[model samples]
Target chain A: MANVSNETRPLSPHLQVYRLPLNAKLSILHRITGVALAFAAILIVWYFLALATGPEYFETASAVLTSWFGILVFTLSTVALWLHFANGVRHLVWDTGSHLGQKASNRSAMIGLAFMVVMTIITLWIAIGG
Target chain B: MRFLTDRKRVEGLGSAKQGTGHFWEQRLSAIALLFLVPLFVLPFAYNLGDGYEEVRAAYAHPVNAVIAIAFFVTVSLHFFQGVQVVIEDYVHGRLGMILIIAMRLLSTLFALIGAYAVIRISLGA
Candidate 1:
């Protein structure tokens, strides 16, 4: 308490100073995926609208979505979707006052990441193979 | 309104009195989407490589149309609230207020357009 003063203090160590914990990393990923999903929502809405508009518009939208680049973007988005979703469930659990400990939180994060990868692969296979 | 002690008045009650409402909405939407998303994605995945007419026909089913509409509404609401929390956390002052407004409008627009599209296909219009 003696050293405390009114002078401007330097900022504490931040992103550059420390490696984030697993849960923290996953939390950041959740925010990122949420943002990505917002953009994906626009594309999805547009797809539906094109279908309503006419066959020509539908075909155009479909063509773009089925292209290689489109497929890549979609694949990533799907992965993000699953990751965000799984992490969301973890959040809901925490909200209910369960799984609040560091061990449980970290475990949940790994599980969510695993779920994301497995689901993405399965969905992609089904989609591409159909 | 006159019976409460100061501690009782001040302890648990939030200033806005609406935080629980927001929390419940987010959780309820999350629960709905947990099931609906998988259901929605299955048919969507099946129709991935299909042509325009086929895809439209798939969505033309009454059941498909209804689920799609539900998915759109719930997702838009959930997305709006979720992003609003993020904005409130990281942004401040005039910018945050503006963003919250923009997000609300955007989500509403997407929901409206999505519902219209689903209805159009379902009715074979």
Candidate 2:
């Protein structure tokens, strides 16, 4: 039998052992939201295709898209889009050799999150009509 | 007899060398989208509740059609690059290669479809 014991393994910093800082957490979320937005992009393409296909197809898409469940998914994706976009802008700023300090990075991350929330609310308000 | 230094000859032979191009393309597309996304999304959000004809007419505008096409193209390219990085980081071996290829094909197909749809709408067809 092979010796397989947890005590023999060296400990590494992991989610259970260490708490990630806000900036680190947001950075991870940025990648996740980016992936989410990618899937949403596929849905957008399908919607456009439906629109171009004909009135019947467009009506079907519109109906499904405006349903309660559909709107819920759409709103969630929209929020992800804003978060990804805001964090991406923060990344671009860092790429320019500025704002690389921890303080600046943390501050910008907070601002990015706030911006995402405000933008998502505003866009959704405009979209849902009120 | 060679005039080139060893360092110069080996400059682009490593992994970091190849990553520069991918990184720059992502940044360029990101910048393009930073502007074009707002342009596309604003009109799109405004037209959310519009009917078939109204939405079609909105897309028919030259500026709207052009921006929509640009947005589709840039976003697809960016999405492909971003997902490729994700796959490279998390996936390995034959599966990673297959996934990367699939991502490339899917993003390209979606981009083309989106562009064609915009063109069709703009043409009043």
Instruction: Note each model's CA RMSD in angstroms.
Output: 3.5, 3.9
lDDT of 2 by residue, B1-125 (tens): 99999878876766756636788899999999899888987677777657999888888899999998999999899989999999999999999999999999988998899999999988977
Question: Per-residue CA lDDT of candidate 1, range A1-130, in tens?
Answer: 6778746888666877888888878889988898888776787778889999998998888887888867877888899989988999999999999999988998888898899899888888888787
- Over B1-125, each residue of candidate 1 has an lDDT whose tens digit, in order, gives 59988867666467556537788888999999998888887678778768888989989999999999999999999999899999999999899999999999989988999999999999989
Q: What DockQ does candidate 2 score?
A: 0.64
Candidate 2 Cα errors over 4 Å, as ranges: A1-14, B5-12, B16-19
Which candidate number would show the highest lDDT if scored against the true structure? 1
Using DockQ as the measure, the top candidate is 1
| Model 2 TM-score, 2 decimals | 0.90
lDDT at residue B108 of model 1 (Cα atoms): 92
DockQ, candidate no. 1:
0.74
In order, what lDDT does every prediction score?
0.87, 0.86
Docking class of 2: medium
In angstroms, give how far residue A39 of model 1 lies from its true place: 1.5
